[model samples]
Target: MKFRVKKATKNRTCIVSAAPYHPYQRCKAQGHVEFFSDFNKDSLFGVITFYQHKYENKVIVDGIFTTDIGIDGIKTSDGRPRYTAELYNEDEEMIFDLTSAVFNNAIQLVSIKKELINLEICGDEGIIGKAVVLKRGGEEIARAEVYRLDPIV
Candidate 1:
């Protein structure tokens, strides 16, 4: 028998359009992710683009994120790559984060629907939110700024 190893590539994108009546209706957000795994190299990158509107209601997010995981990536005590994602509101307060084991799986894709409530989106500033990725017990790896979407009138 013979075994051959090849590089693996994964790409994923998420698009969100909140309902007309939803608090996030005036918000626009998109997330992109890319991961490559191979016998020789492993790299992961992600970005988030977002816009917000004024509202006191809750915001519901719907989408799925997919990516490739390399053995060389961050690992858990059980020897599994550990990748995490987090979201923050205008105040820099954490809205949510994928930290559960279920977030890290052998599967190449995962589906997620999260609701963010009690967020302060009444700001006139274009910068409304931010998405970031941090190294395991280390500094930030990457970040994306979120902006406020102007009303169409």
Candidate 2:
């Protein structure tokens, strides 16, 4: 008796190819290429990565200063200072009314790490709502449109 090998058939069986096995091939296929110039300096501030959790976000600020300058023969002995400067949140509703005193005589700066949520809204006629960030200064820092999807079957 003689036995013979059978070839794979489309309906009964199939052949699968392995993913790219070689490091060079894999790198070439999905590697990131960064362009650099001779003028590039390593002492730069560099790119900072900020990761936000599903519920929280962070904001970073740098190089803030507050200076007190006396004016027009005003001396420390004077009862009232000649010049006073302050920075306030343009939007008073979002935050407390803070002043230089609150910041320990330094330039008013804030670094917030707070929890947040991703909200989605929908309306009739397939009109979706958007999420907006309203800064204390009345600035819209970011906005995202909502998307809707059916539950998995």
Candidate 3:
């Protein structure tokens, strides 16, 4: 319903998509997003995040940014290099690994760019948005400037 963002160094622009309506009730759902950017060489430090999931009350938020996207996350517990992954709640909690999360998805990005993120959301009676939160140093910035993409394709 209401959202507030702080400010950051490298400003990133964003445009939120129109929220989808319930096929049956046609009532508006709740949703939002914020994205940020990173300039790391390891590709890990300099990365991108695209997160979107149906939370409680059927709300879906989406966004991309250059900072750490806040979500319950974990890495490989062993002594191996930890690839990043995010945990989101749906009917239950779901894990989305950067490399191999969805087996059925048609496409996958080898590297994730924290500055560039796209959301894939679907379902009936669901909510979705594109105005993602952009992060820098792990905090959501309130001064990050945002813009809209052209509506006509």
Candidate 4:
């Protein structure tokens, strides 16, 4: 997917994770995540894949996501703007808040950095979640629903 990233300002920093949140917990199983627009369930926003594991001695989850949304347009109170995806369960309880990954291209539309990773949204079922574009103060501008695809094995 093509994405546009605004020019990176001086001191613009991107957060990258080098290790799993739960370094000690062994991954037991794997699952898939795909997002759809809230307005229309059939409209797909993107896909995220997660692994079942534990963090800080308690069970937790993390995943990687990719989409077509433009990243640089997002605003923040501080000069450091970022995007995030919030995942919820069937009960409408939020399970995870993911920070959008950093993109490398500053001049034009790029493809690789649109992929986000290591989103630590916690839940047991690993069935579904939601994606949204939040205004600086936490207002929703665009939103999508998360769905787990059936495993092949």
Candidates in order, TM-scores: namely 0.37, 0.18, 0.22, 0.37
For 83-134, candidate 1 gives per-residue lDDT tens digits of: 5556655566766663332234322244343344333344442225454443
Among the numbered candidates, top lDDT falls to 4
Worst 10 residues of 3 by lDDT: 102-111
Which residue runs does candidate 3 get wrong by more than 4 Å? 1-81, 90-92, 95-120, 125-152
lDDT of 3 by residue, 110-146 (tens): 3242221233433442223222222224443322112
Candidate 3, residue 79: how far the Cα is off, in Å = 13
C-alpha lDDT values of all predictions: 0.40, 0.23, 0.28, 0.41
Better of 2 and 4 by TM-score: 4
The local distance difference test score of model 2 is 0.23
Clashing pairs in 1: 51-147, 52-148
Q: Which has the better lDDT: candidate 2, or candidate 3? A: 3
State the TM-score for model 1.
Answer: 0.37
Tell me the deviation in Å of residue 35 in model 2. 28
C-alpha lDDT (0 to 100) for residue 100 of candidate 4: 40
Residue 13, model 3, lDDT:
52
